[model samples]
Target: MSERLLHLGHEVVALVRPEAAEVVGAYEGRIGDLLDPRTLTAAVTPDIDAVIDVATPLGDQAADAAAIAALTAPLVGTGRGFVYTSGVWVLGATEDRTADEQSPVDAIEIVRYRPAIERQVLALADEAVRATVIRPGLIYGHGGGIPALLVDLARKFGAPRIVGDLGVRWPMVYIEDLAELYVRVVTNASAGTLWHGVAHPAVAVKDLAAAAGAVAGVTTEPVVWPVTEAADELGAPFAAALALDQSVSGAAARDQLGWRPDGPNPIVEMLDGSYR
Candidate 1:
């Protein structure tokens, strides 16, 4: 996202760990930790044109709330944009419905606070800040995120295992496509709007498992792991999220900001492209 914003000729000031400061290449960066309210405040200085939070809250509820508030407080009344990163899990299992920005939330434990955080972000518009919520789907690309786990499992155990049955699916967006959407929202979106960052509304977990199997020279059949067992192997909340059947579209991003997601979908790419 920082790179894309820089590509659009915007001067980006990224908040990264002290060790990561050298890695942003040409962009200016503030060395800080997201978990610390003081560091977050140090990063969101008055000179910043916009603040994009891509960090996940990493502490207890009170600390997370405090950190989030510290991050959002500096932008109030200043009118500088605040782009809060949330995810599709906040909308929970969509069943047969294709969720949009206005959909009701039934979040898993990991992201239960996101709905409230998003509401707070939107309400910041009342303070004259152009606040927006970016609810990205399962972000996968460059040999990382959840699909990488499938790749690893396929290599080690032949058939890749999915958390649930073949019917389960997840909304997906390639990293580049998601980055472009972020740029669009930063430059063009109106205040108080929420945008879904999904490209393909849904992709079957079995299909991704098959992609992993293809890379490993194994059969495409998937083994369904029990959710409870998965919870132990992973975490309860993360396992539940993996098993969720979510489908969502980036229609609001498309219609509102003329954003187009041209990056390759994860299923095919995981099989034949970068994964190799």
Candidate 2:
């Protein structure tokens, strides 16, 4: 999305490691490390217009909070925008209902730290910061994120392995559409607002994996793996997340920010386009 923001004519200043300095073509890139507090603090200097926190920490919850506080503390009270990237996993198991921004959130164990950080992020509005949160559904594309696991395993073993019985509902969004939402938030959203970056909010996992199989030109049936074994292979935290049945409402984003994701649903694009 940083790249999209740059294309939209925003002067994007990105932090990068020394080895990656060549990757950032323009926009005043800087040499910095995510693990170093000084690097992040220095990067969010007063001259910067906004600070977007898309970089997530490792499994340490405390470390995550500390990293966020370090990055955002410098931006508070500046009335500058602070866009925090959150996820729908924070609204765990929304199977019976389509959760909106106002819906009560009970995050799964994997992302329990998110809700608190979300509250802290939104509270920045009170401190004169134009803070907003975007909770994206399963983000798939660019040969990365969660679906890469499916594609990788499928390539190796014939089909993508299912985490559970393939009955779980997985809300999804195409990567490009997700980038568009970020650009929308940067261009038009109000402070303290929350938006769901969802395209198809309740795509069945079976269909999702089937689409992934098609990406690899494989027609193999999805083999259901026991939750414990999935956890062992994909890690407990991530497997626990995959086991959730979630659906979210993108109406708030569409209505407020005029977000129109003019792209194919993730399943279609994954099967016939980018995922290949």
Candidate 3:
């Protein structure tokens, strides 16, 4: 996102921890840490036109809120924008249904912590800041994402394992496309808007694995592993995610932001080795 913004001629200031300075220094932006309120205050001055919070892990929600509050407190009603990053995981699992922005979040037990953070960020819309939330699906592409992991697993295990029916559908987006959406939302979206950053309609897990196997030059059938057994093998967190069956639509973002996704679908690209 920072790269996209800079490409668009916007002066970007990114927040990073001290430990990440060496890596983040390669990017053309200011680096600071969210945990330190003073660092944020010094980085985001009143002259700044907008604030985009793309910090991750969701566990840093409190510090994010505090940083946003501190930055926007005096600038309220000044029309400065505040864009917060969220995830589609808050929508949780759906039964044979596709979720939209208004869909109620029935997040899996492991990810229930997301809704509270979403709510807190959404509430900022009422505080006179031009705030918007962007919820992105499983982000892939640029050689390292979920699909790549599957390809790696196929190479390691000699076959891509499929848990259960393997028909479960998951929504996904390429990192570049998602980055474009984030740039649009931060720059042009109105206050209180919610956008889904999905690109592909939906891809079946089994098909995705098959494509990954093809990319790795391996020919094998789906190895059906029971949910519990898969959980034991892949660990609870990852296995729980694989068990979820949910898809999301990016129509809203495309309609509102004039955003278009041109990136390759994970499965197709995986098979063609374009994603590697």
lDDT of 2 by residue, 1-276 (tens): 878887778888877788988888766888777667677787788888787778764567666667777777787878888888899999988867899999999998888888988898898889888899999988877777777777777777798677877788887888889999988886778889888999888888887777777776779888777789888777887888888887788888888888888777767767776778
Q: Please tell me which model should have the higher lDDT, number 1 or number 3.
A: 1
lDDT tens digits, residues 156-261, model 1?
7777788877799989999989999889888777789999999999999999988888877778588897889888878888888889998898888888788888
CA lDDT, every model vs. true structure: 0.84, 0.81, 0.76
Model 1 accuracy (lDDT, Cα): 0.84
Model 2 misplaced regions, further than 4 Å: none
Candidate ordering by TM-score (highest first): 1, 2, 3
- lDDT score at residue 42, model 1, on the 0-100 scale: 72
Off by over 4 Å in 3: 25-31, 58-75
TM-score for each of the candidates? 0.94, 0.92, 0.89
Model 1: worst 10 consecutive residues (lDDT sum) = 56-65
**Model 2 steric clash pairs:** none
What are the per-residue Cα lDDT tens digits for candidate 3 across 1-276? 878888898877656777776666446455666666777667767768888777655355576567666655654777778877777777877677788999998876556666766676667778777878888888887777778877777887899866655777778998999999988988889988888989975778888888877877779976665778877878776777776777888999888789999988677677664555
| Alpha-carbon RMSD, each predicted model | 1.6, 1.8, 2.4
lDDT of 3: 0.76
